[model samples]
Target: MSYLKFDKTVMINLEESLTREVLRTNRKGAYHCTTVVDCNTRKYHGLLVMPVPAIDDDNHVLLSSMDETVIQHGAEFNLGLHKYQGNNFSPKGHKYIREYSSETVPRTVYRVGGVIFSKEKVFSLYENRIMIKYTLEDAHSATTLRFRPFLAFRSVKSLTQANGNVNQSFEEVTNGIKTCMYPGYPELYMQFNKKVKFVYEPNWYFGIEYPKEQERGYPYQEDLYVPGYFEVPIKKGESIIFSAGDSAVTTTRLKSLYEQEVDARTPRTSFFNCLKNSAQQFYFRPKEDDAYLLAGYPWFKVRARDLFVALPGCTLSIDDPVRFEKIMSTAVPALRAFMSQNSLDPVIRELEHPDVPLWAIWAIQQYAKAVGVEKARELYADFVHEILEYISGQKHPDMKLMDNGLLFANGRDKAITWMNSTINGKPVVSRSGYIVEFNSLWYNALCFYTELVGGAPVEKYDKIIKALDKSFPETFINGYNYLFDSVSGSTVDWSVRPNMIFAVALTYSPLTRMQKRSVLDIVTKELLTPKGLRSLSPKSGGYKPYYVGPQYERDLAYHQGTAWPWLLGAYLEAYLRVFGKGGVPFAERMLISMEEEMSLHCIGTIPELFDGNPPFTGRGAISFAMNVAAILRVVDLLKMYNAE
Candidate 1:
């Protein structure tokens, strides 16, 4: 189920616009648990500030029993209240509130005590308190908000709440939120191809915050006296109300405003759906992620899935030839390093994931098909020599393999590659035989190398392929059920993760149809949740449900149990591999639901993961790359396969 809309009690002044807005969490909103936007602006600055003892309260949890909604609204946010008693002046400003630049934009901007928010003809205006009212029509709505500075911008300072009075004088009233975040002058920090960046600074304080999460706020560069603020529980499709003396007027007026305007809009065709779907592909995109993207919002590493999907996934129709080439451009380097490194010693190699997999050879062949055989061979020649050098190293005595070939102990965490950890906090899911995904990638490497350097590479690479073919079979658990992360000496025995989906989802894998079926069945049965695929089975003790919070706990929570919606594309791909290809709209129709739901939040993206239970708790995330990238590729697969 999605999140519930909250009825927030927002505090404002004489000069502020009397407008209201509903708060929403970007990702969780999909599951009906939406977050909210601040009134002063369409978007609010996300800061994890320390609480001032006065305004701070206990953690507030929201639960609508009948609706099956549960939300943890932490009390830490309310601690931002600091009393400003220093400067006193004749409070010239009458009212202060936030309003939007124009009615054309539903997203709002805040105004202070002296702002005027108004609407035009054919629409009723609710300008009683602060000249704030709205009217929506079928096509579009138009409105304007104007802000006037407080009495020549009087020496502003935090004042004590004179009993939380709304009509108190500016200097006497403990009001005015001092946020570096104030659209006060909300400015953009950086402009990237994909995202818009804005950095928040405290007006009075000089502190450098990583601005990461709530717990992550440790005095970094400078320890500015940054005080935190409280959050109100707000809901969707409803208005928030706050008043000191006249409760009846505020309610009666707001209700009248809603009833009067609700009838005017001939037909409201909300674009929430359009907003969700349009952000998926290369629509309106000025620039796409390079074939190799060094990420900021998304995590690190050159993602194989992201790149592969981005090529045909996002851009194939536009620059079909060039973008596809760009996708494979690094395939050569990635393969060469992989083979060389693994070839150094049988025990030394561990593979990540692959785009085309065995089809790397085929993808290369396809590249040749698109460009020419000469270009393909020429590109192959660029990196094949490194394989020989790595082979020399592998043949050496001192060259040892990590974890006897199954896993490699890397970093203090002992993680092997990216998907190297388990819920127990053990870094590598070290196991016997090659991981399904790893073997798939390795096989692709061999096939790709053989395609590049024919004679010697075919023979040499063939021998290694034979070893993998042998080791992989031995690794499969006829005794238990599925494959683990890797195969070497001691294997990580548990976890039927969705990693195998890639092995099947890849253009090709070394496994036979029978082998792929068994693995896919195990994953589908145990790991596949409705939202996506869970990291662990709910039936297992190791299972941890996904939610939000502090990192160390969150990381442990991240992969262990969270049902990642992005990973669902893998399942969609694999399912189509055997069962649905010849069928119409195999993947195309499948994504429409996700596109529809996800577009509700991130202007054009999907969340990192969702709750692994019924009603699918979508929380603590928004606009993750894997989600968008995977959809891109999966949609491409549907389009391409359908064309075929």
Candidate 2:
């Protein structure tokens, strides 16, 4: 992506530590954040979490701490510390969502440490004071970092410690002042919520009160907005650290942390530093052997195979290939586990529960193909055996749904479409009954298995693929243009959507050029957005703009109308097929720009999703493996394009 098209205020560099950046968005969606860094601990720190002090209407500070467990909110009202109390079941979004505005403050303190040289960050919580510490030492000297964010009481202030509650409301606390000293290092770390607004108040204005203050060595630092730099004042082999959270003190003791720097000590060190710190903020548990670090976070967990759709962009390109294997291998057992539980159709891996749509399998096979053969042979064998079993059950001699060409999933409501199936209350199989995307997934999986294995009649799979190809265009044809959303004879849903793209991105089984063009034309005209292809049309009743909010509402916002960045991979693949690939081509430019913009969020990693609007902001997953996996595939494609 060229600098011109990629230009958008030069935003923070993906390569620099959060501490080294000039400005970052603070919690509550604010636009300004000034940070400080402690080079010894390698842990970053922050002050004034956000503009407006992150006091939401709910009367709670959203402690969106990724690594630390306790969010030590500095209390105001001059009555000392007043803790809000309430209990809210986190949808696991707690692993990622920094509800810097939750109504209650858990009595437990939040503490997360950043490892300057490790792969993961430590997050823990306690009461009263929150401290995060990291230590690393070589033969010469040991480097230890400890950050303590504590409650500060003003001199002669009349106040008492209050009870903590979760349902507490937001209240403005003082723009506190507290000074932490590391004899050797002074580049204190600071991390305010990036979603909030902040301005660096002058450091000189706050350094008062403490009589022994003017004796320390001068703190070397830089003013980060433009070209500036800051240095950690540690011995060549020693380290220093900083503690975060809104520490309380009268405005007199606020430390000087306003500085930034570009250029890295080592690409690998800087790279790992960012991931290590961010990791402290979220949870991604891989079942011992997954291809990606983790495709699951907070709530919306997906299948292991689904993660491959975005792998190469993850560890393959930038990280070690061996680590990538750990991620890929995880799918083997994941699939087996998913299939083993149910006997009705062993091949069906319940995509969470009740029904296993073929689309996920579609993506998995594609991922395997992308990974190449030797690395995926066992995966293929298991996949085929199960698929062949499924085919045996479903292919009623005539090769159709159940005993005929009807549309339904294993006796469920006929609307077994991927868009609208509900199981145990959770909306499963949404937009049901012979949905085009589902069938596309179905048809492609069949053809792919047939191509790989030498068991069933290859012609049988070929014929089905051909049949679906011909049937789709005609059955879905809408006279003037565009294909139907599904062929259960259901109406087109009257909403502009990008479900049709699957027919284009899928391999083997089908889609004619004109049909592809038609589908592409419809989507380009309606579904394309700055972030990604919108799932449902705004004109549709179900669409909802994504915003920070309560859980259910947020989940509803997801996919219902939210933009999915992962879809950009699908879109890019489709674009490559339609316009031919290569960065030289104009289409490739769009793709590259898309990649550049995405990489900016995590220094080259794709976000899970983005806002479904212009200036479409990437949201949720920071450094999510699945999303990055998709971008990696795109990168691979770009390379392939270049080779061609």
The prediction achieving the highest TM-score against the true structure is: 2
lDDT of each: 0.38, 0.39
Give RMSD to native, each candidate: 15.1, 15.4
Off by over 4 Å in 2: 1-238, 241-293, 296-305, 311-325, 343-364, 367-379, 391-407, 410-429, 454-460, 489-492, 538-543, 546-556, 582-584, 592-604
Off by over 4 Å in 1: 1-376, 384-413, 420-433, 451-457, 490-492, 580-589
TM-score for model 2?
Answer: 0.56
376: Cα error in model 2, Å = 4.1
The sequence of per-residue lDDT tens digits that candidate 1 reaches over residues 271-318 is 222222322222211124324321112212234444343333333322
Shift of residue 7 alpha carbon in model 2, Å: 17
lDDT of model 1 at position 74: 22
Backbone clashes per model, in order? 65, 80
